[model samples]
Structure formats: C-alpha cells, structure tokens
Target: MQDFSQARNQVLQQIQHACDLAHRTDVAKLLAVSKTHDADTVRAMYDVGQRSFGENYLQEACHKIDELKDLEIQWHFIGHVQRNKTKLIAAHFSWVHGVDRLIIAQRLSEQRGHELPPLNICIQVNIDAQDSKDGCAPEDVIAMVEKIQQLPHIQLRGLMVIPAPNHTQAFFDAQALFKKVALAYPTLQSWDTLSMGMSGDLLPAIQAGSTLVRIGTALFGARDYSQDR
Candidate 1:
C-alpha cells in the first residue's frame, strides 16, 4: 500500500500553500478519487483522515460502501450519471458530482430514501464545450438550476467541471458560473461546493476558487483497469 499518511499530508500542504498564494482563507477540501482501488485501500485512506471519497463506477463504489459501512465516510459519485444507475447511486452515495440533466436530478430526488439526508449534487458543466465530455452546455445551467432547486430530496450545491488539461481559463470560468448561480439563488444556503481539479491541475483550480479538488493517482497511485474489465 502507498504511504497514505505522507501522501495525504503532502496534498494537504499543497492545498494550504495554494490557498495562501490565492489569499483564500478557506482551504479547499480533498476528495480522494478511489474508483478502481479496493475497499482496504479506502480504509487505509480513511485511517489517514480522508472522509470524502469519489468513485466513478457504481458497482465498484457500492461494493466499497458495503465493505466500509463502519467508517463515517462521505461517498461521492463522480462519474457520468446514468438513468438506470441513479437508484443505487441515490441510495448509497452522499453526493453526486456529475448531474447534468433535470431528469437525472429528478430521478435521484425521487429515488433517494426519505430517511436519509438530502443528497448533495453539483451540476456538471462542459465549460470548454469538449465534444467528448459528459456535461451540459454552460449556457443551459441557469434554467437547469431553476428547475432542479425544486426537487426536495436533492440539494443543489455548485458546479463541477473537468476541463481539458492546462485549460486554466476554464477553471476561472467555472468559478464565475458558480458565483453567478450563488448570487442568483441567494436563498440556497447549500450552494457552496465547486468540484474541479484533479491530481494534475489542482493548483490552478484552487486558485480559481475550487472548493473541492478530486485527486486520484497522486494519492492512490496509478489505477489498474484490468480488474474493471
């Protein structure tokens, strides 16, 4: 296993240094992207005080959630939200970071068990309009937000983006969108999280006002896709 304690501390230090450079008093929270890693690896990360873990695959994530039931971990579904998978995602994860459509949000709201707390979600935006990306157009966000806020079981948090590598301007654009939404919906107290950045480009994202950074390879090492196959 990787030295999670040292890795986590190094990441934390980098976050702090980035925040200092940006003059941001509030440091960004790290969401360990533990998609392909096993449950034991996640448990090791949890032991090092990482409370939030982001997963891309629903089946793999659900298995880990079941195995790590005893840990007070906040699960985040960071992959493309499929219609058929929302039920399980709603029932298992605490946050959904790739909600692009109102229909997806609606299904998640309807499927989420009432006994659990409201599911926190971030609207995924294709800030750069990449053809390969799975997010809504930047222009469609306001209308989508207006409709999604009415859902009772899900709380509209903020924007999540996966801009092309070195496309630093996209990070600033996402920040602007996040601020615009927050200003427009002044009544929403939960409109706080901005899920952007990854292991490679976290510094610019944090400086651009990303509240939560999703890190994978740096902390957990390279993922083996053979098991996923």
Candidate 2:
C-alpha cells in the first residue's frame, strides 16, 4: 500500500499540471472520488487535506457522511441518482453532478425546503450521445437549462459530460457542446465549471476546458470489490 501523503501529492500535482495546461489557474477543483474506499482511507485523505470528495452510491455516501461528519468535507453525488432518493440526496449532498431530467430536478427542488440552502446542480450531458448514459443529449441542454432556471431552490452551475471512451476526439466535441449551451443560455452566469474527464482521459479533457476532474483509481488505487461481496 502507498502512503496517503504521497498519493495525495501526486494527484494534486496532476491537477496543477492540468490547470496550467488549460490556462485556467483558479477553476481546476479536484474532487477525490471516494466510492468503495473505507472510512480509514477517507480519514487518511482528510488528514492529508482533501476537502472535496465524490461518491457514486447514495446509501454508501450517506453512511460515510455520517461516519465522517467531524471532517469538513464537501460531498458530491457523482453516480446515477434515483428519483426516489431525491429528498435524502438534497438534504445531504452539497452538490449533485448527475441531474439529467426535469422531473428529478423538480422533485429535488420541492424536497429542498426554504429552510435549507439551494442545491448546487450540474446538468449531466451525454456528449457522446450513448443510449445507455444517464445524461441529457447535447441538443436538449437548452430546454433543460431553461426549465432548471425556473427552480428557485436549485442553483444551476454548469454542464457535465461523460464522453465516449476511445474516441479521444470526443473531448473537443464536448467542449463545443458546452460553448453552444453557454451561448444559448444567458442566465447560466457560472458557465465556469466543466465537470468532465477521468483517470484515463483527463489531459485531453483539460485541454478541452474541464474545470473539475473526477479521479478514483489514479489517486486511491484499484478498488477492492470483495467488501461488497
């Protein structure tokens, strides 16, 4: 096993390199994808000074949130979110990165009572237009953005896309799509965050203008699925 200090530094260096290459100094935010990692690892990361962590599973995330409530960590829901869990998700997660449907948005907006702060949301886009991907297509982003803007309880931040793997050219295409959406929607003032890329293709995504990169194995090493079994 690698030392957590070394691992954290390596990832932070990579983030700095990506940001420098993109000519975007301040926008690059590293969200440590902590799904499947245990509480010990999460605390280790926290000990090393990582404030933002990403998780895919709702229940799993909730458990971790409860366990590590003492740490000042910002949790981001990075996986396919179910409509049934809107209330819990809204109540816990500070940001939701996979919102693709208006119904889900409406549910979250309604469940987010006025007592709580507005939920920070990013409309996920399947830039590659994969049929199975859980994001809105690039062409439909404008309509979705318009609808999301009307919800006073949800703050529309920007767009997120999971491009098709192996198509390295998809990064450029995704950036073009983001530019188009930004041009179409004037209310989206914070068209600043582009939550794209992962371990294998983050460089190109950064070159294509990505602000946040969700990295898992690269930082924490391969996941041990045996725990779930």
Q: Which structure among the candidates has the greatest lDDT?
A: 1
Task: Please list the C-alpha lDDT of all candidates, in the order they appear.
Answer: 0.94, 0.84
Candidate 1 per-residue C-alpha lDDT over 116-219 given as tens digits, one digit per residue, 9 for 90 to 100: 99999999999999999999999999999999999999989999999999999999999999999888899989999999999899999999999999999889
lDDT of 2 by residue, 1-229 (tens): 6687788788778877877887875746788899999878999988988889999878888999999999888999988778898989988888899999999899889988788778889889888878878888778888998888889789888877887787767778777877887888866786667898888887788888887899888879998776651
Query: How big is the RMSD of model 2?
Result: 1.7
Candidate 1 Cα outliers beyond 4 Å, as residue runs: none
lDDT of 1 at 77: 94
Q: Estimate each model's TM-score.
A: 0.98, 0.93
| Number of the top-ranking candidate, with TM-score as the measure | 1
Q: Model 1 — TM-score against the truth?
A: 0.98
